[model samples]
Target: MVTEYESALEVAERLNRLTPGEFEKRTGLFSTGAEAVENAVKIARTWTGRDAIVVLGHAYHGRTLLTMTMTGKNVPYKEGFGPFAPEVYRVPSPYPYRWAGAATTETGIAEEAFEQLVDQITTQVGTANVAAIIVEPVQGEGGFIVLPEGYMTKVAQFAKENGIVFIADEIQAGLARTGDLFAVDHEGVVPDIVLTAKALAAGMPLSAVTGRAEIMDSVRAGGLGGTYAGNPVACAAAIAALDVIVDEDLPGRARHIEEVVMPRLKELQAECAAIGDVRGRGAMLAMEFVVPGTRTPDPDAAKKVAAHANARGVLTLTAGTYSNVIRLLPPLVISDDLLEDALDVLAEATRTLA
Candidate 1:
């Protein structure tokens, strides 16, 4: 087991070299994504002097009490777990596949509609007491929904103008998984705080919350830290992972995954009317299952598709509050041949479902 007391400073130093912008001015790392999120909220509360946090629909932050309240989809996770952290509110996610017409024609998917929902929540919740508006740039558990292109910028602007911290939950899609160091980077928007994890240490367990210095510093010195927050072994692995990402050009690899998988997914869409949507960014892809000849979500079909793929030696996961979305999370190190093989399995699974 990786020692909890190991030094992560060296790894953080090296990560600074790989993606210098993320922590160019930061001084430390975090233990897990959950810890990072907790700290991010604490800092936001401090910065805005607000006690409430608002998150978008279908989000999955972590399993901690605070996170469970922020998680939009409840099934195996939030069930029987109540009396969660207070002041945690949920709003609609501008998921085009599910939330139709949320984007404008000129601006793309109606992110403004999402922002309007946030605005309404802020007004109702009393913006003065709202500390932050948290969201996943690409909703991971919500069917790999990519927010409209300009949504992040507009949301950030709204938050700033309203004195609310804007946090981007990039835990699942960051660390170069989406062809950019961070998914928010794709939209050219800077978040007050960016939460990262999962692929950051490759297979190691490490997560972080990097943000503007002022907001991060607002938390008292003793307020944001943990015993194993920056464990050395995970740090070392994370440093190595960052190096691999840059040296092996995994961002390009992610783009390649998108290129290879999208066509096949689209083909599946064409062949099967039961496939409702083909969406995602870079390597994080998903297909929404639906009733044949209708848009009604068919989670039962999705389960069959996943079981068929697993039986064929390809592991798959299901997401979405309805559990009708099939998600693909192959390692970035997967070979092109293997990638193609996995896609074939997925296609075959889709056919079986059809």
Candidate 2:
């Protein structure tokens, strides 16, 4: 029940410092990631005077109505939850591993796919009516999917060309989770608005939308806040957590996790035909499960592997539109020994499925 005077201003200042670019930045705090996302869209619409919002396929923005509508998956998030918010258009995400009939390369058909994505958005959702293009730099619940190289920059360019706000929904992949302060940093693409949460307050229920000051100021003051938005206690937690992330260099730790975990997962993939693809960046990685001889997704195998890991005291999450990806999201502060032990447990789980 602490008041805004206690810590909200401090949180805002700290968040502003972390946001990229030289333009004067402004931040608004919210109690949850969904709220942050909802407000970001509102701000974009208000500023652009437009009705359409563009979202990538296999993105998971949040669980609220508008956010759920933005999410690509339908079963658990949006099932029976329609009639949904309108003017929300979906576009292809440039998922490399699953690009049909395309050769697998470092860029994974991104150049070709990105051109098609641009065509779809222009034709389907007319740039003039688009308020924003919101995307998860790395798709979180949609199976830890990382966009192929150059894909993010291209999307940002498209948004800029059309006067649409580019919003990077970094709720799941931000704050050192992907070995960078913001996942968009990997592509060096500066977004017009950045939505952050999850690790922002170290799970203290704080989320923020930081963007260009001029754009953020478009929304009238009273239009943006809620009573509990940016609770003082939560703000205090976020301040402390942010200090820890920088002082401890959690981004470096995430990179170390990638070095340790990715090789092991690749090794396991080598031995198991069910492990179809090993993809993702930094510690935010996943292995998609498929039938032995084909690209056909095998959700059951993913379930079995996760169940086995759980039995061994290693909790795991399954994702993907097809529910066939075993996504790994280990804490940045976890010890090398504990992470290795968990990976060992996961290795055994994959072997059991094999």
Top candidate by lDDT? 2
TM-score of each: 0.92, 0.97
Indicate the residue-level lDDT of 57 in model 1: 80
lDDT of 1 by residue, 269-329 (tens): 9999989988888999999999988889899999999999999999999998889999998
Candidate 2 lDDT over 1-354, as tens digits, reads: 234565888888877888777789999999899999999999999999999998888989888889999999998999998999989988777787787636477475777667776887788878799999998989999888888878888888988998999999999999999999889998898999999988999999889999999999999868898888988788889989999999999999999999999999999999999999998888899999999989999999999999999998999999999999999999999999999999999999999999
Off by over 4 Å in 1: 1-7, 14-24, 100-108
Off by over 4 Å in 2: 1-3, 101-103, 106-108
> What is the model-wide C-alpha lDDT for candidate 2?
0.90
Each prediction's whole-model lDDT (CA)? 0.80, 0.90
The TM-score, computed over Cα atoms with residue i paired to residue i, of candidate 2 is: 0.97
Error of 2 at 251 (Å): 0.3
The weakest ten consecutive residues by lDDT in model 2 span 100-109
